[model samples]
Target: MSDAVKRLAIRDRIAVLDVLRGLAILLILLMNIPAMGNLESARIDVTGWTAADQMATWLQRVIFAGTQRGMLELLFGAGMLIMASRAMQPDGPVAVADAYYRRNLWLVVFGLAHALLFMWWGEILFPYGLAALLIFQFRTLAPRTLMGIGLVVLLASGHWFGTQQYNARQQLLHDAPAALAIKAEGNPLSDDQSATVKRWEDLQASTKGTGKETQEERTGRTTTLAAFFKWNAKFWMGFTSDLLVLIIFEASATMLIGAALFKWGIIQGKRSARFYLALMLCAYAVAIPMRVIDTQQYMTLALDPRPGWITYQISRLAMTLGHLALVNLAISTGVGRWLLKPFEAAGRLPLSVYFGQSIICLWILFPPYGFGLWGKFGMAGMTAIAVGVIAFQVIVANLWLRWFENGPFEWLWKSLAYAKLQPFRKTPSAIHITAPI
Candidate 1:
């Protein structure tokens, strides 16, 4: 086959992979909705929430927290290996290296559009693309090596994050009382004291957001397109930095594990049913309890770091793998395959589905540009609407895929990567998971 053909002609589809990707789409919404709708500072510190919001927050933390992003990172790793494989290249006009880099660069561009244009400051594609570029060199390593390095990075990053949290807690504990004392004495607070008070108040507000904070945020988001863009752009700066520092490291580690998993045949459904079952059970056994405890600590301990923060990386990795194993186990079972069938549409068009979700929620549902329903829903209500949106996307994705070869964004990505307009309508020969989502 020509290099160009190899760049675009991989047609084999892994049912288990599709189902797992589809599951990721479903899982991401459990968290993304509230992040888009609520006050930006209230992501974790829901201090004075109603019982339902608190329960919803804890339940989601236990079930979904890091696993959704984990799945996406790992899948991107799998996709990276698939694209970077030397088997896809030979002496020809098009090179796998060029295609791989081009595809990911365009992904970065798309991510920029998603964040800057569509107003989702927390989008993943930017970091995912950047991480892919950094790690592409490591794809050819042995699976064991990849996994070992990934685990090491994961541990180091987790420790660093935990240490930062611990230090912040210590600072707040020391400074908050001093700042309060100055205020009580009616003395002019020093500059540092004033800054300390601001930090302490922000922390407190994260738990129980003030009306002014929430209202100001809502007004900024819903006042006009310019205002909305400015709000998201400003947030994009800070959020994207955090992603680059900590989240990207975590994502890179997960993707490395993903590359290892793909090579080990675990992600490919080449393992036996018994193997998947044992893996699923073993992984969940290790992760679920830690995650539950972690959530409880974050909820109960004010301004204190979660007990599981240090080892939380292990729990997230284990839980994500457990979810992957469960999906594979389901694929091995006849009934399980049927249940996952609905998700194939989302899996098939991950780029479009992912972007479409932002357009629906950020563009239409919550912003002044659409329903103007920002901050109207709590965690539970936002998630409830997320359920409806997910269902709608699945149905629409299925319908679109029936007559089209690629989702619109997928087609654009491939065309740009290949530097040519590729075929788009459905045909016997079309692309599949030869590349990642």
Candidate 2:
């Protein structure tokens, strides 16, 4: 077969991969949902919540937050390997890097637009683009070397983040006595605070940052814009510098592992039940509980660094490693595969699905939007709503993919990336399913 045909044709289990991706989507929501405070408050700190709220926060942090992002990172790494392998056959590393880099660049544009247009700021695509740009230059690196780089980046990033958090906490605590006391009353916002909050909300509602200079002009001319940049810069650093360093490292490692798995035929549904079962046992048995312990301990002192910060930081690494192990086990087990099926198709178009979810969520919660249900939905209610949202997404994903090759946003981004239109709708003739089922 020609190279183009080969590039277009590879034996991949769409069902299995999709399912895993879907689970990731749901798990991400599980992890992030609590970050949205209840109806009255725009904060996500569910620290001192009670009963259902407390249980939800703790359980989610332990199970979903600890494990889900790692799984996604691994999957992304695996995907890179798959793409890299395909790009390598005819030309060389340079060719593969070029193709992937273009894809990532497009992804960055999409992410920036998505973040500005939608209310969600925790977009992963932006950093993934940055990582891809850097990693593309190292396409020829030995896998071991790549892993080392990933580790170094991960550790350095973690140290930076932890240190920043430590310092920030100290400062917050130093200022807290007065700030907390003043804000401790039933009404959390001061008169000035309430006005500032309202103005910010109004700005967010109206600004999508699409028109060339319109949004920028408005923001540039106002004090709110300055405040926005200041607050946002800090927010970006927290995630990008610290948390993302770990996430990126984990992703790079997982990608290498995925490449190895593909080469060895494990990801092609070729691994034996025994191997998978063993993987599950090893990863879950020793990892999950340890992660749970670490997460609770870490969260307990997140706002205010405690005396045992050093020990807690060490434990966080342990927890992260445990989560990685769990994700590996999950990949091996048929459970993740089965659980992910409905959402997998959607995950293929992550940009679309993620943004769609944001639109729905914001419409539901934002005051100027639909139901205005943010702070009102307590732990149980939000949990239920989140579940409901997932179910809806599954239905939507299934319906959309049945007729379309790419999700709406996915098609747009890909079209822009390639500088040409590609297939979007799945016609009967265009659909290609392997035979001998």
Candidate 3:
């Protein structure tokens, strides 16, 4: 189809999708809390010696291990399609494309600021913004064509990521003891002292796991933009490369599927309940056990990093696919309805909640500012904090949405995109927020 001649498909109002987004938001926070603590410390903590730590570690293994990012990517893709369907008209493909791209470009700006200034270099928005540019070109594609492209992307990314993980495992095994040995030979006081306290104060930004700083020198008050870019360029490239492949693939596939489902009348009440039930059963039966076994084995492998690279990749890929299927089914079924209320409310204000969690965690763990609980908190403690955070966010989100048309960040993003203020406070008559069905 000629791009200009092609039409944009409109969307059915699906509250469940927002709930799904909410779930993604919450799960991401759960996955991130541990990592957030690590970012504060600037060093990796691998010891799960205690019972609670072990259980929390295992839970993280089973839930997030690889699936959290994958699921979030899927959700983002789905969200793109949904947003496009809403903002675009059948005969107005160009308008839709423009608006969508503009939204993403702004996100890139947000991500860059978040990464450099906020010191959360682990942010995914930049890559996603980049990928969205590519995906936007596919707006005019047939549903099937989009799905095919998504599958190809997913397969390519999975293979690429698996290979990288394999290499990383080998390097870590080789480097761990050597690095430890270097520490032992250093000056007694310097070798024994942890640089974490110093690193956090210097950066004021929590980065990836705790810091040892012997290998990499701390960038002090004199950190130049050029130097920051040099460090960030490598950091982002390495960071995104690991997950980008998976992100692109799962994201594309789930998005295409979502688009297809919406097109096929399934999302708009076009499909039979019976068909959805069958899909749910098939997805659950296959996905749950596959995830369970893969996670258990993954943990086993993490503890004993001697396995062949090829074997680990195969296991991870298999489980990743299962996780995708499970998530799809969850969304497809009416089950997502139960989760949608708070989630949609939360997602409507995603930025406020997303960055809010980071700020909250920073207060809890950053030394000299708050509790200084970085390496001290066990896995259970982290999970407990995450749960508490999630509960608090839900309450906050609901209350915020009752009076506001969009969450705080969502309003800001919209205003930025539109080049002026969009609606924020809900009018009495417009109090009912409706997703277009």
lDDT of model 3 at position 144: 78
TM-score ranking, high to low: 1, 3, 2
What TM-score fits each model?
Answer: 0.92, 0.71, 0.72
The residue-by-residue lDDT of candidate 1 on 1-437, one tens digit each, is 34533543435666567768877976698778887776775535342367777888888888788888899888888887776665323432346667777788998999899899888888888888888887777877889999999999988989888877777778888888988998889999988889888888777766666635555566678689888887788778977776576877888888998999999988868899999999999999999999988888877746765658678888988998898888888877778877878898788789888888899888888888799878778777777898899999889988987778878988898888778886679776553433321
Task: List, residue by residue over 124-222, the lDDT tens digit for candidate 2.
Answer: 777666555655445445556655565555555555656766675576556545544555565576665555444434433333323323334223223
Which segments of model 2 are wrong by more than 4 Å?
1-15, 36-48, 89-95, 139-145, 163-270, 298-340, 432-437
How many residue pairs clash in each candidate at the backbone level?
A: 1, 10, 13
Could you tell which candidate, 2 or 3, scores higher by lDDT? 3
Models, CA RMSD each: 3.1, 8.7, 7.9
Candidate 2: count the clashes.
10
- Model 1 error, position 370 (Å): 1.2
Cα lDDT, all candidates = 0.79, 0.55, 0.57
Residue range 1-437, candidate 3, lDDT tens digits? 33432222212335554555666677677777765554323423343447787678777765566555554565565666666764444565565567677788998888787666654556766666766766655655777776676666565655666567667656555555554555568833343233432332333222332244312323421134454345545665666666676555555555555555555554333456566566556644654565566556654533333333333333433444454444444555565444445666775566777777766764444332456554456678888888988999899988887777766677788778657676778876555544531
Compare the candidates by lDDT and give the number of the best one: 1
The pairs that clash in candidate 1 are 47-207
> What is residue 11's positional error in candidate 1, in angstroms?
3.6
Deviation (Å) of 356 in candidate 1 = 0.8
